[model samples]
Target: MKGWRARLGFLVPPGNPTVEPEMQALAPQGVSLHFTRMTASGPAGTHEGQEERNRSQIDSIESCSALLAMVSPQVIVMAHTATSYTLGSAAEAALVARIEQLSGTRFITAFGSVLAALEHLNVRRIAYATPYNEVTTLQGKRHLEEQGIEVVSYGQLANVRNIYEENDERAYAIARAVDRPDADAVFLSGVGMPTLDALQVLENDLGKPVISAASAMMWNALRVAGVQHSHSGYGRLLS
Candidate 1:
């Protein structure tokens, strides 16, 4: 049977094209991935007007979660990373609690999963890369610092017309450029930009852990659903 192990659900932004493909490619055997586009849109291409976009997704969460809950997925993920950045830690906690209560299923955010993955790996410092503008990129840095994860070095993609249109080669180049000798890992901090195909290659060249929002989310989703996993040829977070 499909999803014999677990059925994972994701609510992503309508403009995003990377999350489903990246996550589904890395999901374990018997684990099925289901997705629904949340009522989220704004200044497309770049993450312009993202605060409004985040709020739109938050305002629409209950209905979206309710609709997603109909499928009875073992876990539901709020797959946008910027929403957590906009909401901050305390608000995000409350949001997760409320979503869990309303959905009758556990809910996690992309940043939450990335934080869990970083903690599990004992990474104190990360070389961060994102497809956001300088403002949103610094916001993500601040978010991580608040949780005690230091961003030793960080940069955003050059002239990123749209994050969803980014390819693995660009993701790879930015990560490699931002990686630091002192950092424990390289973190690609956006769900829209593709990273799965570059994670292992980045790790090989840098000789350390490489993680993305996409990789971290899928890794944590499998764990939250009580699935035993040891995926190889991926980054350390999954293996």
Candidate 2:
């Protein structure tokens, strides 16, 4: 198949079962999404375990990203949102810079992409939802605040061992639960949580823009790749 627009390289955490399918579902025609997994181990939902898993990804990113560079993808997307929190915004930016320097490709993380999306939508106050432990969720909240977005309300499906196991209904419920009347947008964090299926529903119900890690990743990947296409059914960021 001819990739007339661009080829996207995605780096996802090992054992994640949702990012690939979710990204593919949001990709526009003429755009191709390729993925490689970083090394990660240990039980999920524990702070030490999550840190170890993130460390594995950080340790293995160079080699894994090098492999993706071989395809000459226009943009590289770090599909793990928690990695940004694990490394903090500054460290994560440095890590992305290093990856770009090594791979000779531009890079975007799920967290970074979501921030850009929120800015693009002019959303200052947002209600956030995530399928992470309290520690990771707090990190995400801090990262968002550093970007100048106010998190008016926040909720999490705490202690979820595998975010991919969450169904769309659960995702919708979380978004609805986290939404606040003062929020300009609803941000559903965690790329591994199935969210595309509920994006439109959430937007309609909340009467506000809805953004998810997966949706923002796809939108940012397309924009960074110079593909000026807009997709429907996801949210205003894409459409």
Candidate 3:
């Protein structure tokens, strides 16, 4: 309602608890974020049966559409990176398009944001770290490779369910473990995995750029909200 203030609505899995604060921490001035949880029946706090977990996710888009309608945000962000990364770009884009057609609003997902960020940096090589099962993690790597970015290395944490249960420590540990000397950048996938607190430190320690799903989500959302996108001490996407 205010010119300087823009509202961003995020649709996340019910099991996810990391998107909010991580995105919030990266939000630029004059932008506010809100969230809507969709059905996410899974192991609850670990990265287990991803196929079953994402099945619930596929069923939740309509609910996400409904939530988008209620929020009337300038843009809706699909806050889970795994879905987009594992589902492939076409599937992710189709979901965003479906939600946009349903709600007459635009949307972006974590994969979309990461893709955009990578393009902005002109990077064609990357390494990834994920707290997803092996199946999902490989799917993510394949998804990125399909986009023409060479996957130099990857690390999988195989965490199965909830994100709050997997906190900053896990992210930091995985980040340090996943950094590859040959990769142009390191990607910490999944907004629910909590990487904002570890991203900068990882960059400092690794001496390379790092990008997280949570950070990318905030960057893209802010651009959609018409905010001046700039930040210091983060990654190249914002800096």
Candidate 4:
């Protein structure tokens, strides 16, 4: 009866050290998290080969999901947001539909979850922050624009040697730095950089909602699992 209420599965990237722990922290009682890490073949931390690493991880998504499906979680979250960049906004539904059809379980992506959270919060324009390279960062902006969400402003974390090594303070800094008064919310994009701990404070300091891929994923996953969950101190989505 560990997950008698609802069990949420997460398909994570192999090198990410942030998603599982953050989701665990945000999970409500009776709801459990399960993880299946996808392939990451190219390189570990360097941005010089980040594209290759991203491609490798997404290439193995279906296989990883198939393996994860054996556990029969109510919802499976693809916890890498940038993978949607490669797949493009147009193909997002098809990918999720295909996976759900194959696995007979619901599927959601980190990027998709952010969009859902933004919509739920009635966010029109947002300030975007990320620990990704210029190419990957711009791709996220484009993907959001495709969905009718405006990126009022955006920033990338400087001197990020490895996204997985980032912590909450850095997460708080970039989110606050990119926010503008005209923006409806601040969206932190990147599953590897710890963001949940920064979410509440950023919302408090900025007087606006701060949405992150990590936080949004957990909120949406719980909703998909039919768990009526809410816990304050994280962000408005979960609270």
Candidate 5:
């Protein structure tokens, strides 16, 4: 670890294989990202047991917070967007406080990061796309609305089962599915639903800013790490 730059730690799901590589590609020259995996994969099992999946996510934060303390990294990154969305505002704030108190390090979550990116970009009206079910997708919309961002229109692929099987084709399809003419900016939600590779393609075709969960997470991480690199190829958040 000698002469190495600041390390950003991500608490990601064991099944998630996208965020780390996306962050690495978007990270600045001096920053390195290390991840600590949790048992969370996705919130879907049987048709009637979806609630159980949500319950499982709450268990990861404390362990992740403890794991982050071992590395003594400059920042702790929460890579799960669903956890923040599922837990709501008050709980999310408390989670951050608990992590900071436990690790004595700065922390950022995907949901919080996207909100920050929306603020930095001055995005008021937004269109959203996700691979989650209607219930979960609406929950995310409500969360953003509570933060004063207007979700004009939203689309979901409605893939409630086997979320790990989601690939680039689904992300690109959802990106197209959610693109509406009335929205000022677009938000591609769901950390497990891949979208980083198709962001530029979506933005180019849509002719507006497109913010994905992974891109916003990386932007927020770098900002928290105090890196000043002006990244290109991601979105206006990076540029």
Candidate 6:
């Protein structure tokens, strides 16, 4: 329960049920995780609803961050990956910097972390999968492309009401369905998806790196917090 090395604070969407558990499973011995929810509502089944929910939740970051700051965490993570599309890369960087200044903590976003993880593994072309409608999936793909990563193939579990409730088997299936032989890696987007249990298997079966939103977030948070422990059972990104 003691954070001997560093404590990490997470800002998650209100209805999300996966971020806390997944991040906790990924944390190292000396690291601890704390979470705060951002206000949001509506179904995640449709792109319009998802956008509304994301906007509503992101509006609460400033206030929620203020509360998390009182805990004095070494790092704060923005756990909602979809918000990165709301603000482009440059704008998102500025927003993170602003939050850091306000909270006096280093910050990492899910999208940014995924990008870093891909770059770290020298993965240029990726097969992307998400538990979202086609519209939201395309937005995520566009965002990645704008960041200079190629999305050679993609798939989605369209009309998913609650991504957190998705099973590990489905996550693996989606990743496999989208993957191509030419892709350097496979990316499973969304922190809400239960991806940790499937990451290692996917990588082993595909013979390449596999990265997920939750794994990427944890890796980046640990790196930023100076926790050098390399974890196994998730994937090569964390190991």
Best by lDDT: 1
| lDDT value, candidate 3, whole model | 0.78
Which window of 10 residues has the lowest lDDT sum in candidate 1?
Answer: 40-49
Per-residue C-alpha lDDT of model 4 across residues 114-153, encoded as one tens digit per residue:
9889999999899999999899899889999999999999
After superposition, which runs of candidate 5 have C-alpha atoms over 4 Å from their true positions?
40-51, 158-161
What tens digits encode model 3's per-residue C-alpha lDDT throughout 85-197? Answer: 65677877788788888888778887888888888778888888888777788988999888888998998774445555777778888877877888888898877677777
Q: State which candidate, 1 or 6, has the greater TM-score.
A: 1
Q: What TM-score does candidate 1 reach?
A: 0.96
Candidate 3: where are CA atoms >4 Å away? 158-163
Q: lDDT by residue for model 1 over 1-239, one digit each (tens)? A: 35289989999887888888788788888888888888867665466777788888888888888888998899999998988998898999999999999889999999999999999999999999998999888989999999999999999999888887899999999999999899999999888888888999998899999999999989999999999998887788888
Task: Give lDDT per model, in order.
Answer: 0.89, 0.87, 0.78, 0.88, 0.79, 0.87
Can you give the lDDT of residue 65 in candidate 4?
Answer: 88
Tens digit per residue, CA lDDT, model 2, 26-111: 88888888999888877653445787788788888889899999988999999988888889878998998999998999988988
Candidate 2 lDDT trough over 10 residues, lowest sum: 43-52
Model 6, residue pairs in steric clash: none
Worst 10 residues of 6 by lDDT: 40-49
- The residue-level lDDT of candidate 6 at 67 comes to 87
- For residue 201, what is the lDDT in candidate 3? 79
In model 4, the clashing pairs are none
Cα distance off (Å), candidate 1, residue 111:
0.4
* Residue pairs in collision within model 2: none
